[model samples]
Target: MIKTNTKKICIVVSSLGVGGAERSSALLSEMLFDLDFDVHIVSVLDKIDYPYKGKLLNLGKLKAEDDSKMGRFKRLKIFKNYLKAHKFDYVIDNRTRIGLFKELIVSKWIYNAKNTIYCVRSYNTDMYIYPSKFFAKLLYGSAYKIVSVSKAIAEKLNNEFGFKNLEVIHNQVAIDAEELLVKKTIKDNYILFFGRLNDDIKNISLLLEAYSKSKLPHNSVKLKILGNGKDKMMLKQKSDTLGLSNHVEFLEFLVNPYPFVEAAFFTVLTSRFEGFPRALVESLSVGTPVISVDCKSGPNEIIVNEKNGLLVENHNIEALTNAMNRMLEDKNLYLQCKSNAQKSIEKFSKSTIGQQWKTILK
Candidate 1:
């Protein structure tokens, strides 16, 4: 059902998997579709797991990799032809464009500045691993606009790249209190931690240590760790070593984790760094208060200390433990925070974030 008068938009990303950036792109595409825009997705890897709107253009199918040196160029040619044929009003690129040569070629020649919007999801330093700072500065300095998901990210990008057209458009998630209330969930009470089991980034070990030290376990409170990864065994072993094998449980990733989220007393995130932690927002959306480490980019922006959740110092196990104890002992504060959670996150609603995209794209 394409509208004759609608403007066509193409969202470009590495893949539409379960990552934060992928989810953001999917949510934005859905919202834009609702607003009568014809949306299209360009996934480099052809890996799409998120629900989205519009046609999908998988450049990876070009088998460019099978061709070696000239494959990427051939794929780019095919993509260019598609863009020319569709005459897309805008191409919002959400992929990390840190590979200077390829990204510069794609951003500069494949897509013109006026028709493309570059997105920066992570902190400035983490955006690209290769090339020098000067190269990153030059690469994004030429875009029509650079979109950052959080103010902290935006500031870091500005301080480093100083892009002339950097814009802050926070990532969004849907929040429906009535709907969440109706969803069937487990009757057991537990504190939840959901997301990848990556210890280096997610720091599940920190969470385990904090929980083991907290007084909640003494009160028969269970800590449930959800999501799967390579570090699952190591984290489980750590839990065992800490004598929390009985109290801390490790669970596999669930497609619909909202029911578990709803059933929790509260949720916790102990990430080393984040683009924008969707877990915190999702937890708050379902009326479950959160306690997160005030990490590099996301937690501080979302969690108002003692308001909707508590923000502990980054990498401080003692502080994290204290925060968990506080949430358990301070019943009045926890109730107040839970009561205010849903209303506080309304600004991040689909409609609001969609409107921001509309303004930026226009």
Candidate 2:
């Protein structure tokens, strides 16, 4: 049932599969739908795995049918026509913006800059904003709003690009009651690492090294990694080289990874940098404590040292090893962290974040 006189909104995303930002975009659609807005989603790629609520414009399908130079131009014309036809009150863009000329054409010709909201979802601002200050300003300066997923990212953008129209809206977590009721399937005392297998950003190599050094291995506590990426083979080989092949288990990505998260002794993240780590928040949301490196932009905000989880100094192998050992050896500390997990992250709940979006959209 559609609400009367509802403002229409279009969400543009890179894809609806296999990435934190993509998952965030899908969740945002659901939030907008619940708010009674006429929501639409435009996925640039063909992959669609996450459940979302919106009428979809899958441009990827058209590309799959014909992927040539002229075909690309045809897709652009279709996208432009769709925007014009809908006349959406707001266009929330969640795709990575690179290549200045391409972004210029899309921003100036395709999208109505006054109503388009550009989202910056990574600490690497280069991926979202062009390198040249002048060009970046020309591309996004006129946007209705520039949403940064974390305060640190917002600060970086302001300090570097001097953009005035910036808002900080952290990524949100939806704690499903049904997922909570799902029984744990894995029968092992294991700590978990779940996210992309990419080592360039996730620094999964550090996680493998830290796990190998930790005392948990000696105690027969396994390390399980979930998700897939280009670095999967490299990581598996590294585990084998570290003689942890038998101890560490590699699992495929699941649509509902909550059961694995819930059953874990504790979840772990070792990313080199993050805009705002959904994994840490998701783990804590499930009442499972997390162990993470104090990364540049996010971990510090999420991990309240010795409260919800352990926060180790970034890139320090010894510190991470010690943190892992402490979580397993110190019984009282582990229980205390677990007890405080869910309550500490109430601020990041879907309702709270949704209200912030309401303010922006209104």
Candidate 3:
């Protein structure tokens, strides 16, 4: 009689950096470890810098960080071969559909494991979502699970690619309620927007345009941008072209963006799509009201329209403009929103979300 190996869970991701998906994976690993499951992680590139300690770790070092299909195939082969020797109860591909076909090929050929899962973190632009859905089918064919970060994303995945085994679990933050709820210095009159400018996926330009058009006094609603990106220079250039250079202030990344989240009158997020934005939840946890473009999943779920925070239609300049105007012109609304917003994060903290993961894995 053959004996079955004990369950060992491993998460395979591009890296465990300060990304929404990466943070969630790292948090889940911690939770699983606490639950006494043998948990480990595998990174595609060993050298990628991650924000937290003991969150995600690399497996056998590989040099195929290149974007080519063959290069990704080789790296996937190496990782899958390693797993073939040591069986795991569950193995998850935390990669989006960049070169997902290679993931499918290697899983089918090398591991042939009974339980495999694919996780997607974004609903991106309309242009790429269709192609990504097609590849997701090929990659996740007959898998144990196909999961997304938010209900908005899961719905899109189901309707677009027909992913049936989908689950919606929000990201769990290492939030300390006692640490976040004190009254912050009411810095006079500036609203804030924070995110990486690298891919322009955050869509800072539209936010700038809306801020510029609001005709609110600079002192009334100045925009402070945080998180550096590859497109930072162009985003700043576009702000200048639109005469918002004076209205915008860009800051370098910090150990904690919480102080900024506290200092700002409110926080804004203008992404095209998000799995579940950590910034949005963090700002709310800190008692700072948020105004976000209802990109895909996170914002609407967090903001109760006019109750806690406000949501605007995706990519609609006028809708975003109205949201800013409403928040700026209505002083009572700001105070009400801020007071109401702080309580919105009760369900998102690690304690609340960890048990959800326990159920998902079980």
Candidate 4:
């Protein structure tokens, strides 16, 4: 038996604002606290709007003190100082890149943490294509265990980088099916495309095009978008140019947006990448069927392709249109997936996966 009295853990991150890593850390902190571990967070970034009520030590946002350059030795020293002062049993780093928050300094200085775990929330394979992959690899050994949010992430770590010592612990989430089935005042005919609208990586531009051609009646078929990012204005402008102004609705960020999850017929995700969308899993928990592009890993693992959800060819709008249409027109297929949607998410429920993390901490 593990010693319940001996439990002490620390989760370190740039900030607990709005991101997958923050959400995961928040949920896991709550779960670990329930299990009686003395949990605390070390926020290395400016004010963490810490949603979780656990103890948060605000280290008064460190100043780089040296340079305005994107990466310079001055900023690195500030991060190095933060790690030296605060100590813990284990350190869980959530920053995805090496240089973003001076995370490398923490890992290198606090190398004595009994267990240092890094949470990988993005597709590890494409790190090379995106900025910072090569640098992140350099900091790999500063941690004892790497917690990958999905198998694709883990495989990328192993296959591409030849790194070992990994574990797969999906995010834990749940939703109420009865609550999710409520019809909005708006008609049921509208399809939805939610997520960071501005990011080209989500292929929202393609989604707008495919949706424009959809037989989903222009009057009845509106696309509701949620979340904000750098490309928000650009996407909205593109929607106007495509003559799809009436078809798309942009919603500002929400503090508690589960109703959006409940209101839609199904959640739509067209990301060029994902670790495992915690939002998709939560939507499925509420019995919402999803039509997602077959991204590298997350969708295929959770969605059974016409079983619990519909998986379409990645980056192809025609295929996305056909799949979306099938969900709308084919009542039998829709019902088949609807019936399985809530049930398919059993593996990622709090009892199952949350306990898995508890096991890790213990």
Cα RMSD of all models vs. native, in order, equals: 2.3, 1.0, 4.6, 4.2
For model 4, what is the error of residue 86's alpha carbon versus the real structure, in angstroms, after optimal superposition? 6.3
Residue-level lDDT for 140 in candidate 3: 60
lDDT of 2 by residue, 30-77 (tens): 988988899999988899988899899999999999999899899999
Q: Which candidate number would show the highest TM-score if scored against the true structure?
A: 2
What is candidate 1's lDDT per residue for 1-362, written digit by digit as tens?
95764689998888887576777788777888888898998888766777788889987666645656688778888888888899998888888765668877886678977777888777635664223667665665666888888889888876765667888888888744454655764666699999878888899889888888899899999999988888999988999999998898888776567888988999999988887888999999889999999887888888889999998898999999999998899999999889988877888888888789889767
> Candidate 3 on 1-362: residue-level lDDT in tens?
12232457777776766455666666667666766667768876563444432234464254534656676667666676667756777886675445444455655675454577667677662422326666556656467886677788788777777866777777776754444555456565678877777545788888888888885545556788887768888888888898876678887764356777888877889887777888888888878898999877678878888878898888888888888888887988888898887677788877778677667677
All models: lDDT? 0.82, 0.92, 0.71, 0.70
TM-score of each: 0.93, 0.98, 0.83, 0.85
User: After TM-score superposition, what is the CA distance of residue 348 in candidate 2 from its true location, in Å?
Assistant: 0.6
**lDDT measured at residue 240 in model 3 versus the true structure, 0 to 100:** 89
Regions of model 4 farther than 4 Å from truth: 1-5, 47-50, 59-87, 100-104, 124-138, 175-189
Write the residue-wise lDDT of candidate 4 on 1-362 in tens digits.
24364556777666776665567777777777766776777665654543664567544344333235644454455444644555556667665554434444555554553477878787844431123446555566445778888898888777766656688998887443444455446555455655555464677887787778777644376788877778889989988998878778888865355667666777788888888887688777767788888987788888898898888898898998888788888989988988898789898887898678777776
lDDT of 4 at 134: 68
**Candidate no. 3 TM-score:** 0.83
lDDT computed for candidate 4: 0.70
Sorted on lDDT, highest at the top, how do the candidates line up? 2, 1, 3, 4
| Best model per lDDT | 2
Better of 1 and 3 by lDDT: 1
Q: Cα deviation of 120 in candidate 2 (Å)?
A: 0.5
Clashes in predicted model 1: 0
